[model samples]
Target: MATTQTFICFEQAASRTDRRKNRRGYLVALLASVLLLSACEVRLHANLEIEEDESGTIAVVMAFDDALASMAGPELGDGLGEMSAQLPSEWQAEPFAEDGFNGIRITVPFESLTELQDALTALTQGESGSDLPVGELMGFLGDIIPTREGDTFRFSLTMPAGMDQALGEELGPMPIEASMLDSVFDIRMSLTLPGEIVSHNADIKVGDTLVWNLSFADSVRTLQAESMLTSAISGALIWVALALAVLVALVVVLLVRNRRMRPMAHSEQVPEEG
Candidate 1:
């Protein structure tokens, strides 16, 4: 009888311990869900714009830092070699290999508003319907701009709000018109994306447009590069949270079982002493 009673006590204690462990794990899981729900997620936004002349020639105007212009042509003859450097290999097989893109160009790199203004003035004066550098002459004729030394450029484009959102995602092949705005050249654009449509925004030209079939593909590569770091950080946070939850549940189970055993052990000792 003593042996049977001892065995029954052990089984009951084990069952209670198991139930407590289950409860701890359930609570831990609930806490984990709450933590995850409370965590803030950073949104990744991409913006891209394309400017094309009336002749079906396209120039991709990127709003990124001016450092990228290093990959642009020196003066339209440095070949596709320079641009291919800044882009994915797929670009080589398309725009780089096409003839229309051969005519596409880069603008002077801009470091500040003053520099940008200088380049614009230079372009405007040079293309003065008379004497100007071939590069500036091209701008006067509403052709592509060269990638001059600079950080940013101002092109005239009448853009709508929808285009702004789409530009954030870098979605492509939108229509752009290069027209004259009195003395200024206006690069008017109209884009319709998955959700909305943007009608107008004056674009400031900075670098040369990447012409050719591969322009779109090159853009995707750039967009992917910009977003990769953010995505990785988000994924890591998710895993870390799950691991911490598991560790907390283990600690809770151990503490609960220890508390239950201590009381039973004290009671048994008292009986022996009596």
Candidate 2:
């Protein structure tokens, strides 16, 4: 009986040791996962909406994964605040949270395409005293200035093929690996025009909106879209001209009929006198 009780005690101790080992293993894995996620996960979206009068707004939203946001803690909020403070007076910014993402949304309104280009240039080139990940990625997008030819509007953007090398040359050595840049970051852009879509090299097109998911590649990547604006005034003028022509034709017909009837009535009355 004494030997059997001793064996049972040893088995119980072994089981307790196994439980502790399993818990430690789980803790280690959880920490590693958090670190990996926090190291590389970001999403950036930029949208440009142009009105019929060529005036419009540009909205840029930059968000991070929930794990990354939680890990960054107050530092992320502080960085966004600093960025907002540095923006121009016309630019507006507010905190954004959606679909488990935490970030900021910036809006800039422009009166013309030229002004829009200027705003985009400032956004990509302006100096902000924060190390926000979105800033460097925005620099990768080349200048996007839309042109107007009569009733047609067009714009094209070429994504640099050698993005990592260019970034290294312009902004010094990058901390993220070249191969991992695409996987770690997601960049998307959409342009909403005030006309019917004529042609576009976008990944998705919904009516007048063209969306492109940007990525780094070995060859030149070009995104071009053209739209033709329909003029309401021209349509109205055509209808007015048609109505006036119909009125003139009706007046001529009535005058001819009246002249013929008067002659007939005169002949009839003169015959009775004869």
Candidate 3:
């Protein structure tokens, strides 16, 4: 009877201890995900190769600062790993690391842009039709922008709202200092375009490759400003407006000439009465 009671008491204590640790982990993750910000240096380089048939391959390679992977704990890394694992098996062949950076290189094949879009949406959001946690955690990553021109592809990443943007007055004190987090993290991007790329607006352009020279901190600031700038009318629209203005001016000059000529004709038709 004594042995059985002792065993049960020990088991109960162990279970309680496990529960406490699990609670701690939950609190830590919740606070971090909700209050604290992700590291600033989250770099993703996606290489796209599209055929004339709209079928192609896409390789999304991502890397981050070691300090970030270490500090953010397994939540950050595991989230990333989960993202890569969720991809189709055939395309998950690339090694997850290169040089000194911690990363995952996912190479996927697509039958069409629509198919690719579905895969991308899944990556950002996750597979649907289940109660499981598919992609809720990734919502905090950032705004991922992808622009495609033929076989050329570009992605612009911005940190999450509360994490990087200029905060509004309503949001009370920030959970973490920007400067402190900024010092420990950084992000950059690059792309390997297909075919002979003769035109590009990237900071770093080498043959067919494009790269952004800005740091993640600088990148977010610049991108926000860029967003504001691009909201205006495009250059082509401005040119169209100018063309309309010129046409209107020419019409006004023609009308003035016709009116002046009409006066002369009316005077001459008065049979020189003066």
Which is the leading candidate under lDDT?
A: 2
Query: Weakest 10 consecutive residues, lDDT, candidate 3?
Result: 222-231
**C-alpha displacement of 14 in model 2, angstroms?**
53
Off by over 4 Å in 3: 1-44, 51-53, 64-85, 88-94, 128-186, 194-198, 213-274
Per-residue error at 159 for model 1, in Å?
2.0
Counted clashes in each candidate structure: 36, 0, 2
Q: RMSD of each candidate?
A: 33.7, 15.4, 12.4
* Tens digit per residue, CA lDDT, model 1, 1-274: 3322332233245553443333322322222232233331111111223222111122222121122122232422333233334332111112322211232223344344344445444443332311222221122223222221122222232112222222223322233211111111112222111111112221322232211111111212110001112234557779999999999999999999999999998988774534
Candidate 1 local Cα displacement, residue 37, angstroms: 59
**Number of colliding residue pairs in model 3:** 2
Tell me the tens digit of each residue's lDDT in model 3 across 33-134.
332244334444555554445567766656655645555555555555555555644445344665555766666687876676666565544433011122
Encode model 2's per-residue lDDT on 30-142: one tens digit a residue: 32233344464567888889888899998888887787777666766876787688765666899989888888898889999988877776666554411223444565443
Give the TM-scores of the predictions, in the order they appear. 0.22, 0.65, 0.43
In model 2, state the lDDT of residue 229: 76
Report the alpha-carbon TM-score of model 1 versus the true structure: 0.22
lDDT of each: 0.29, 0.67, 0.46
